[model samples]
Target: MTSVQTEVVEDPKGLLNEDDHMRDMERLRMEIVAIRQPFDSVMRVTGRIEPVDPVTWTLPNVAVRIEVESPAGQRPVSRVYTIRRYDSALGEVEIDFVLHDDDSPAMRWLHAVQPGDDVWMTGPRPHFVPDHASGKQAAIFADETAIPAVFAILEAWPADATGTVWIEAGSLAAVDELPEVEGVEVHILQRAKDEAAGTTGRLFAAARSAVADVSGWTVWAAGERQEMRDLRNHFRAAGMARDDLKVLGYWKKGTSSSELDRMRLAEYARMRESGLSMDDMRDADIAV
Candidate 1:
């Protein structure tokens, strides 16, 4: 229940020394901001305070747990968000939250929070890492929720890096703009409301035309489980080695993370054992 305020920055000399000769080298490093103290009650916004610090938290696949009150009750939602900006001068940790019209407590909070609104976050756990050494370049496939994380990775890329980025959204207008990068082509796909969840249409369709020659580069993708599976198959059919692609599910449609624990238990019981790691799931050996 800790009330989060603007973080205090340290080590002034290190902050100023690196800025003198900037060349897109400053990657968004992350630090663990653990729950130092438990909150006795919920936080009440008492006005806004901007955070000022250099090198704040930002990374791809990093999740933050947020507790909010909704029609059901007090619930915590672990969400995937992108860091829009980390302005140390303004002392603010800005994040882009995807909003929806629903009972999701997290979405409700995003819509309600204001300039003075304050919330606590606990994260900086090991989530995902890019396989830079696997290839000289890479391709990223993501949806709206994963767009920010994909961008964070690109920010840390070397100037000579080249790749493709395929982003799917509800519509073209939902997309704002993409960051300028050499050898990186941005493709936008529009999804209609009636489409079933976890479906992969546009991405698969563009595979041959845009993603054909990417076998030599690492492929990174995150979204629904079905889409991720389709991507894995697509990559496999394209002659990509099992070790050259990284795919994960940010979430599953109609599945809650809490319920997923129970599902795991059921699966374990049905299988009568649990002794498999991701590394063990190679080509033709992957099991959902």
Candidate 2:
């Protein structure tokens, strides 16, 4: 309900202007070039953004926030998605939407979108990539939502580095789409058709079983909030350093993304009032 409220929160103190805000927050108009269903559980969209800077747009694990309609159809809401692939030469980027039963903002946008449709978005914000350079074995745990990021990350994976990827998905076809890297072994944890996405604790279970010692590994994981939070805490308790573990909660089990955004903005405002910067606010620290 709060998500549909039309209220503007202005930054009178200009805190957003600091750091790389201007460069990273530039809005871009993307024209949908094509849309297809590569797998039963995913909708793949390819769009083109004009005047693309190869240097900035061509990065692994980059994400964009696309504006969509709120549930009540009263206000515009935005959803963050990963760039599955980026072709700077063609000025094209592909994003994969993991289909769900919920009638959320992103699902509405996906159903209504067409080839000629234009959408406004801000970002190509780079996210974490595995620390292959650390000379430690990388352990990655992802669900269907994070498969796109894993796709891009593996495309640019270093040949000399060794890692293992565990993906939990309801569709095997989705997992089959990932690239075959020489040093990386990908294991699929198949979910039952009737089982809900976030309810299954398979990813966490597999992670705990496979990774006995954290000393030789650097962990990168993303999925449902509670699972990722548990994974992060488990690894930390196993003696893994903070820098060595990169875990993110892409979504929560029973919460809407709009609600999550509303809470984030409220926390951000509180942080600003307390003379803190964006660097002090961590998504993992946010209470759902």
Best by lDDT: 2
lDDT, model 1, position 119 = 61
For residues 12-96, write the lDDT of model 1, one tens digit per residue: 2332124321212232223222211112111122211232223434444444343343223323333334454344444444455
Best by TM-score: 2
lDDT tens readout by residue for model 2, 133-231? 789999999999999999999999987999999999999999898999999999999999899999989999988999998899999999999999999
In terms of lDDT, the poorest run of 10 residues in model 1 is 34-43
TM-score of each: 0.64, 0.91
Backbone clash pairs for candidate 1 read 1-39, 51-91, 52-91
Model 1 lDDT at residue 18: 42
TM-score of 1: 0.64
Instruction: Report, for every candidate in turn, its global Cα lDDT versus the true structure.
Output: 0.51, 0.85
Reference-based TM-score, model 2? 0.91
Backbone clash count, each prediction separately: 3, 0
